[model samples]
Target: MLKGRPLQYFGTCIALLNMLGMGWPSPFLPVLERDPLTSITKDEGSWIATTYLIAGPVGSIIAGIALNKIGRKRSLLLSALPFLTSWIIIAITQRLGFLLLARFIAGIGGGAIYSVLPIYISELVDPPIRGFLISVMGTLTIVASLFINILGYYVNITYSSLICTLPSVVFLLFFPFIPETPNYYIVNGKIDVARKVLSQVRGRQIDAEEIQELVESNEKGLAKAGVLDLFKIASNRKGLFVCLGTMGAQQLAGIVPIIFYTQTIFEKAAADFPVIASTSLLYVLLIVFSAVSSAIVDRLGRRPLLITSISCCCVALLMEGVNLYLKSQGGLNSIGLSWMTLGDLSFLVIGYSIGLLVLPSVFLSELFPLNVKGLAVGFCNIYFSVVAAAVSKLFQITSDHYGLHVPFFVFSASSFLSLVFAVIVVPETKNKSLEQIQIDLRNKDEHNKGEQTHLLKKYCSEQ
Candidate 1:
């Protein structure tokens, strides 16, 4: 019961930098490949697109080691530095080497933020609005992408990259004022301090007994666990698989390629709108739909929304493939379905924003306890970076070798698989307390314990 809800907005302000840096290169990538100012080959462009992802594991690894030691707020500040530095590099140098390194550096920073920020958000907010706050993160990301696209639309590459540094700077400056989450204090055994912070965030005094209950509940469950040990426990293992699946499905859904290659796709689709306008509209649709999805998440519950989302994604990808295939046949203008490609692109965002886009972050935030939170999230982001890099690099190669429709069709298949996985693996987390989530995870022995107790009582009675 946060009396002041601005805490969520503050979290979004800091986390927005990662996506801003991530989306900055999107609009400018097409220009970098063919513009006379900084003409690079397709191979170089692909490498540049992947360089950030390739470098992400470094940030995640470092964040895993230092996250708790340095604390969440400080760790987030460190993440901002790389984003700011990378944009500065981009602004100062157009040299291919410099640009590549900059993207990679930015990825390192983005990785740190991606790995740590969701955990921060999850711990900061309560369960009911947890989905909503996380949804705001995705919505802000779309908004940032739109902002960067607008910059690319109006300005030169150097100036636009320079302008990108501003938000990161603001985040770095403002984030330190925000307090660390209560979980961080609890994990450190500072129960009094944890209570104070929680009280502050809620803008009212929390009951000491409530904090004591939370500690007792999570003490054994959240004991100091390492990354590899995450698999040793049944509950932790299941949670790991869910996080991995969520990350894997997100990348395979082809969102990364869509961001990196939006201009290329628009050019090929012969889209009805200008490239800038179309990209802007895509972001707007994503933001609007993600906001709506967030609003409905708690009410509708997690599983149903996720099922509907991936189902729509499969259809969206299928239609996108068909649109590309038909357009390749060269009679789409006469048939007047060129608009269908745009519709598919729109639905891709709309569908994912509804479930796929934001829920994965929420999943990671809730799945692991404080002890393994950093490392577990790091592992997920590491996998995410690998998948992101592979998809982005292979997009051009696959499209060149097998045609654009093939990639879209492949993505469709992946989305369908993910839909099945969601049905089997994803539990409804909405409205459940974090402690309850852990209790549910460890409930497999309830019947066995009950039976044993009954057997013991009968034996004693016979005796």
Candidate 2:
């Protein structure tokens, strides 16, 4: 089906692998802790998840720097090396230290790929189908989780790690065939090359107007930009704020912890239910709704989907908290309500997969101008890394001391706050060209500034 546009499929393959690597702990941690050979304590097992995130900021910074100097394609290609190395180490290592080192190395590659891949996809696809193409990454991520869960259940850690390395190897061998994005060429003073790339990707000769728009946008602000430049312009500032807020909402809502510890959560709530079966079913629901979100994102627009998605998360998480609280108090079994935990979690996955899981990265890739997109994405990804790590640790600590209900309540509160933020602040970038989005951001910023100035003048006159 993607033969007509192999770029879309190939470009996102590495993301599937990235998510698989990031989610490796979900199924493997419990197995590792139980194994006599590993001797992993609970605290040490927690770091198995956290260490991957701890190394993310370094990778984000490296990608941000390399994106301009080496081009997006080269930077992405470079990311595969760490993944390849990490999995190899995982396949052979029996020591806990090597496992952590391997996970940290994998995290570096994952961070770099996350920071750069979405931007690359956004630039390559047409605006009409951009949301669908980009949101496919979400679906692939769910697929990765599901795949790893099944694989880990059937195989030992060594075999699982060795199997995971195949995606990275495939990426290394195939991704080079795809051309660099026209935006990269345009910004780098290669207009003729940009035109050819644009033509090739679109499967036709590039029109003059499209080429002219690229030139004009490049002339306006697609020059080389540093991190500080992200704040100096009103549009860039707004874009950065939006991207950061989106990321904050996504991470703070507890997706990372839930993903990292899905089996643990299931085991805690419904010990009788088959953990692997339930987790696999949960991932299946996620894959289904993620595909639904991708199909309708362009038609429905981002704001509505996000508003609905976050609202569902809030309600589902609140229900889950109540269910866990009742279970902790020994009230659920007598009332025959043990099934509520699975049902409530299913609801939460439905909510998260539909919007919260998919849209933040889409916003990151869409909101910024070409000049500062790479740097802005890097910064947002670093913020993502920090929040994800903190949330993961917070979930573990709070659950240990205060019961799982406490962390669920906290996550529910964060989801409510994020819903408010989405309704009030997040802008719709659906069906808009990249250059047009930049212009709209500028115009919207100027309009707000004008209103503020007018109010200030009126206040002075009254005084």
- Cα TM-score per model: 0.91, 0.95
**Which structure among the candidates has the greatest lDDT?**
2
> Candidate 1: deviation at residue 158, Å?
2.2
Per-residue lDDT of 1-463 in model 1, one digit per residue for the tens? 2334676656555665555665664656667767786788878878887888999999999888777788887888888888888888988887789989998898898789888888887778778788787767778777877888788867988898878888777776766667888888888888999999988776777898989987887786457777677887777787899989987888888977876677778778766667777777888888899999889888898788888889988999998898888877875772345478777888898888898888888888887666777888889889999988888777778898888888999899999999999999897788887778777766743655688899999999999
In candidate 1, the residue pairs with backbone N, CA or C atoms under 3 Å apart (3 or more residues apart, or in different chains) clash, namely none
Kindly report which residue stretches of model 2 are placed more than 4 angstroms away from their true locations once superposed. 1-22, 207-209
Evaluate all candidate structures by whole-model CA lDDT and list the values in order: 0.81, 0.82
lDDT of 2 by residue, 1-463 (tens): 1322665555555444544544573667777778899888888988888888988998999998888778888888888888889888988985799989998998899789888888888888788888887888788878877887788888887898888888877777777777888888887888889898888777778887989877987676566677898899888888888888878888877977876777677667765767777777788999999999999999999999999999998998899888889888987872344468778888988999889888988898898877787788889889999999999999999999999899889989988999888988889998998878888988998899999999999999999
